[model samples]
Target: MNEFKCKLCDKKIDATPYFEVHEWSYNEHGELLGTSIFYCDICYSKYLYKEI
Candidate 1:
């Protein structure tokens, strides 16, 4: 399996239930500018709970 690290906490994502947080930014004109972040379940839960 491919290994991934959570962008928030730098924890290794080696199990189930990781998260992907995505954001997009667009100029006045139509455009596609986006970014994604990975998070482990712990950090993801903290994010959802606004603790981080």
Candidate 2:
């Protein structure tokens, strides 16, 4: 089993239920450009809608 990390919040995530991958192609200001995977539903929703 591989361990995954959320680039947005630096939370240790378990890669079992699969991951929702996102990009920082436009959120350079959020400073999450190249360090995270935006793991989980909450994170993905927040990331997609700038709820962070």
Candidate 3:
């Protein structure tokens, strides 16, 4: 299987029982302005932690 890369941190995603991926959509006023970005579990958690 191909390894998934995280756009947020540019790291390889490891296979695990709790592994997850994220899709971030770039929108403006309900319009889709850009392509969606993906983040591996690790980076996704860090991103959310920073927002907390």
Candidate 4:
């Protein structure tokens, strides 16, 4: 079984219910950054519903 800790809520998940969005670090200038951010399913939903 696939397992991971949620980067946002720190919740331990035993299975992947949704597809993960792999992101490459980038800057405002479109340059590569050093770190990457991982979002959980809940966080990703919030991200998608975020107001612009």
Best-fitting candidate, measured by lDDT?
Answer: 1
TM-score of 3: 0.35
Writing each residue's lDDT as its tens digit, candidate 2 over 8-50 gives: 6656655442334544554646655533333344365222122
Mind giving the per-residue lDDT tens digits that candidate 3 earns over 1-52?
5445555677666453132343445446675443233345665632211110
Candidate 4 local lDDT, residue 49: 15
CA lDDT scores, all candidates in order: 0.52, 0.42, 0.42, 0.46
lDDT of 4 by residue, 6-51 (tens): 6556666555445444455666999864533334665553122111
CA shift of 17, model 3, Å? 8.9
The parts of candidate 2 lying over 4 Å away from their true place are 15-38, 45-52
Instruction: List ranges where model 3 is wrong by over 4 Å.
Output: 16-39, 45-52
Q: What lDDT is reached at residue 16 by model 1? A: 45
RMSD of 1: 7.5
Pairs of residues at least 3 apart in sequence or in different chains that clash in candidate 4 = none
List CA RMSD, all candidates: 7.5, 8.3, 8.3, 8.4
For model 4, what is the alpha-carbon lDDT of residue 40?
Answer: 60
Global local distance difference test of model 3: 0.42
Identify the leading candidate in terms of TM-score. Answer: 1
